[model samples]
Target: MTDALERALASLDVRAGSTRRHTLPAGGDIVLPAGSTTLVYLLSGEITGDLALGSGCEVDAPTGDGRPVSGRRTLLAGDAAMSLGCRRLVLSSQSGAEVIVVTAEITPSEIVASLPGTVLVTGFARLEPAAAALAGNLGPRPDGLACERPGDTVVCRSMIRSVLLSAVRAWASTGAWPAPIADPFLARVAAAVEADPGHDWTIDHLASLAAMSRTVFVERFRDAMGRSPAGYVTEVRIREAQRRLDAGASVSEVSRALGYASDEGFRRAFRRHTGIAPSAWRARALTA
Candidate 1:
């Protein structure tokens, strides 16, 4: 099986639509009304920020009096506020700071939903130690400015998504997997499933991995994933197939590779899950 981290990273795209670098002096502040998904990477200096996702507000490292905390970190926007109207993002610095803000093609909700947790809720949280390293890589490349190079924005987007996913997994490991799926044993089971969705996963096999009975595993899996074990497997299969289709694989090729009994069966399953045939989805994805 591929490493779980690799699989999770493979499941997301971070292509950027735009990128800009900013330098802020001490006491500098900026307010961005939500529209496009944004990632603010603090290149240097201390800063504080807040995220207003709808009426719910989350401040990064706020002080006793409820002021935003000052520290260098990464900020990810959750919902762009297109449907909800707009989120308020506030950033301030006590000292000078440099940041590169990138607008992604996809929203925070889309990224979070693809990952295992709601860790992107605020889209304004600090990155984990491991994720911090990846975020740090977003600093100016030795060759030249990132935006100066062709296709560099696309690469930037992938790196940002990677950093977010790493941080999310770290947060979830510290106790964020929901409900019945909160058990460490079940988390491992979930990881294995994601690591190799094409595996012939049965309730008994998954239960053994979790050291639980078939019935217990089934119940917990549904609670954590909101679906039966079989249902989850089907979803994973379809998602993998979707990724392949988007990458330009033929319908027959995807059907065979994902272990579908037949091409027609694969077509039926894909349509049932995505409301579009694989070929049609591919066409739309290519045009998109």
Candidate 2:
């Protein structure tokens, strides 16, 4: 299960946007806007909040003992909270508190969809010490010199990435996400697709690999994976394209490697899956 989550996290394209520190006075509440992924780590304070989720949103949180907790409403010092696809987040502090909030845009949407809409990790400092260490050093500089020095952006981004990774690892450890493909035959088909995403995957070929008839394979694949084989193949290809692009591969190179007949074909498919052109995506990743 951890391996599957690692693969999913590896495929995600996380672009950290801004990191801000907020001080909430007693009885004050703040409303965070929607869009992108948001992480809130309590530096030294207490907060209570409600998440307004739009359609298709899911929420999960784990307590200090790594047990799943539902409808979590409060966060204490050393706790970390995350939300995606929420209409807005309303947080209020009964006693004054301070927090560091980071915003990021993570893609492809399918991968984000697979994650819970909200994740609150209690005792984050103990559960993810490395991330806690990084977070401890993050905030507005005392002199108000924000990212003004050489390599500051890169260093800040690296810290944000580490913190985000730790939060995800914590959530995944609780076994809250969906289970992996259960059927052995379907699992084999998924493995093959992932192994060679550029292959000319057809229903017949995949069914043959699974040792099942085409109709049976299609039905079972959808049942186990929640999508048709062709859809899964497209997803796998797009995931690979994101990975390669983030690794500094050119658009044409990724196109050819993914078995697309032309750059335009790959561009269209990539846009359809990720809602952005591959080149633009790569550029954002580079600057991020």
Candidate 3:
């Protein structure tokens, strides 16, 4: 499932190479930002853990935020149903299982214009249909890498996109975006965020750009994607840093591009989220 979902994102325009795939021991908790939606495909075993809007925000998996997302006709056969405000999403891994996840902020502006559809709006978020569908199909890895299967990655990604395009058409025809996928305000904010990751960003600047009160922006941002404006910016910065790192940018150069207070600050945030120092991370990406 994880592989399928990752492939879905891989096929899309938003950071195909940016998707992070990792393996964790059972019962281990991993924190991910809500700046993007996640599609988890349980691999080698099933991972039964709480799905949350950030580490602390729990929306009741069975009946999230006064909404129910299970056993619905349009919802996938094995899919989950819940109100998905764009909070920085987090998932805990169950014992003896590895999960595949694709976390990203692929707004409608990034996709809707390209693919005309019902355009389900969510808070300040927009889940590009292709990416969302790929997230949905994170299982049955494709065929490419020489691991357990041949062309696993390639085949899985191709099939995942096929499913994603199909699901978008089906859901858009039904005329309503899913609860947790995305909403209106979220969409607008995504447009803004995608416009400039290099902005000298601040909560106030984001609040103004989002056209909301500071408190409102902060709360809504937290509720929708799980991270504060600053937090979301940090995530975006890291993504940018990864690109630079992959392209052979020095850590200090990346810090300047992402508007970090300093290179040290970027290093701290990068390590905290990815469990590796930036210098080391750059080496890995470049080497890989």
Give the number of the best model, judged by TM-score: 2
Kindly report which residue stretches of model 2 are placed more than 4 angstroms away from their true locations once superposed: 1-3, 34-36, 50-68, 85-87, 142-147, 151-154
Model 2 TM-score? 0.81
* Models, CA RMSD each: 7.9, 3.6, 13.0
The model with the greater lDDT, 1 or 2, is 2
Which candidate has the highest lDDT of all? 2
Task: Put down candidate 1 lDDT per residue, 77-127, tens digits, no spaces.
Answer: 221111111455666777767665555544232234543211222222242
Q: Write the per-residue lDDT of candidate 3 for residues 1-288, one digit (tens) a residue.
A: 222222222323222223334466766655544444443333344333343322222122222222222211121122321112244334455555444444322333212232221111121012234444455445434442334566655655454434334333333333222223265666566556645777877777778767888999899889887667777766666666666776798999988887778889889987886667989877755543
Better of 1 and 2 by TM-score: 2
TM-score of each: 0.56, 0.81, 0.41
What value does the lDDT take at residue 228 in candidate 3?
Answer: 75
Residue 118 miss distance in model 1 (angstroms):
9.7
Order of quality (lDDT): 2, 1, 3
lDDT of 3 at 262: 86
Question: How does model 2 fare in lDDT?
Answer: 0.78
Worst 10 residues of 2 by lDDT: 53-62
Candidate 3 C-alpha error for residue 42, in Å: 17
